[model samples]
Target: MPAGTGGSENYTVGQVRELNRQGVPAQVVTVGLDADDGRSEFNDIPFRSLATLSEVGGLDGTIVFVNEPHTVPTKQLSYLILHNPPPIRDEQKAFAVRGTRNRALIVTSRYAAALWARYLDVDVSTINVVYPFAEPCFAEQPRPDTSAGTTRVLFAGRLSPEKGVYTLLETLHIDIIEQDVALTFTATTAGADKPQGKIIERLLGAHPGISVVTSRKTPATMAALMADHDVVVMPSNSQYWHETFGIVSVEAQHSGCRVIASDDGGLPETDCGGVVLVEPDNAEALAWGIRAAVASGPLSRAARQDAAARFTVKQSVNALLNVFAQPAPIPPATIIRQLEEQVLAPSAKVATTSRPDNVLIETAV
Candidate 1:
């Protein structure tokens, strides 16, 4: 599987893993990514490589494409999962949307479906929701002890402005805390290798009383990290980024930790009985939110139990299978072609769909 260090990577790998467990076949086909490109994370999931997404247009059977929409429409059944919000400019995203037509468009949350619908000028129902699940490893994590009068707060998101690392930086000083926020703050180097990540890490280094560590590479590792903490913060920036669905927010709750996230976007929906919503992009609000989480003490056993029933791989995969079972709507072009083939003589022309570099296909279950 491609070595992505964010929620998108976790969701893709987690879905593939669960799909196999449920006897539904799924394989990760990467464009511009190799089998051993960077890290061996999510190595259990099967992976295939293609030079460009266009090569998969002729791929038969049900193909589920994630993130980037393919420029070429699939010859058979397909689905596009819009993990990120649409681009600001209409022209920038319109081409990509129109280029890959007739596939059922999927979004992570109702908020995301509406956001994309408003941008693309389509009905909200046209975009479907398939919420990402917290992999079993997260819930399997042992809850941390928080009765020691100190709440261990962890910022598990990528150290970038959109993820709200900068806002966090301005929120945690003594002036803001003033003994009210009695917590040991820590930040992860999730995207520290990237240009923006490097700058954020440097800024964190200059700050005081903040512990820094390398990003957890796997769900098990990330779960372990969350289990060691009492609370997880997701102060997502609303100005530059509207979080489609904060998967990490649910994951943290599954780990038996309270989630302090922005009130906007789909973040509010990520609550599994332990999320505390605060104003987005406000340092003071985040600081107060942290203080509130600290004052509330440890998450109760009752509150922690809702994650399994509400969000799980079984539910997510079954919902997807149901979506796939629905008959695909035929477009006008497809009907026209069918009519022409009935009256025409023996077909001589063969449609070509291939790239210079061949795409590797693999089967999974």
Candidate 2:
């Protein structure tokens, strides 16, 4: 389960849906209190209340899957952790305590897993790397004309500080205003505070050419917005709130828009040969990247098609199922010895009664 919307929600929803399509029993549980009318289909899949997940019984031997380990109550069960963001030091401590107790940890990228292993002091054996996949919506569609006159640049996400909106504004100032290029900045505000909205308004006010579209766009609307644009720019910084896996980048690529994204977090994973990665937080670098993307001309229909094929929901589902099907670690010999001496003898009778008779027992004596 995840905290809220973004790449985590999108990945979970799409992966679970695809797993169901493949006849694999999969479900998504989210702690989102705000009622979203459309998420009902997935909400129907055995949603245990986030508040009550710890107290709710009967989860033994069941693989509890979690996207963000810090958000969920991991003390309850062994989890397949999906590490995405750059974890805070305290978050790492929490994960370290929980991960050593859980069954296994799975990360979306090797880079993330390596970081966790290094910082959390966990054995590398416990962590697994599984790359995320884009939904079918990102499959290659027809490309629009890129004839250099007026290019539309779309940025579909929250207008928050971590997204580098200020940096994006600076990049726009350099590229559009200073360079005298006709470019449209299409942005949608998802979940930002009043102050952030005010800052965005001020930025937009400074540049009349930059159009700020603020309304909740559905999947179709988002796709349409992508299709309407000639290029997609993601100038996210390496801050805690950076993009993980860059789902919007994939969508833009599928819509046949050249993608220029920041080289941070899981963005490199989304490069997919179609995206151009630029230095994070460098406005000059971003401006140059955007200019190069525009000069590089429209992506060939074949390149976009290849990118779409590379990142499909089916592939993501298959990877997750493969991880799930893999045999969990047998209790370590030292752990077995310790449990046998301390836990098994005293609790065996109670455990035998509560657990199945067929449950295997390793005696200490």
Best by TM-score: 1
Backbone collisions counted per model: 0, 0
| Candidate 2 local lDDT, 250-336, one digit each (tens) | 777877788888988777887666688899998888888777877787777777777778767777667766767878654233354
The parts of candidate 1 lying over 4 Å away from their true place are: 1-4, 37-39, 144-147, 178-181, 330-365
Off by over 4 Å in 2: 1-4, 31-51, 56-61, 70-77, 89-92, 140-148, 175-177, 193-207, 215-217, 239-243, 330-365
- Return the TM-score for each candidate structure: 0.86, 0.77
Stretch of 10 with least lDDT, candidate 2: 346-355
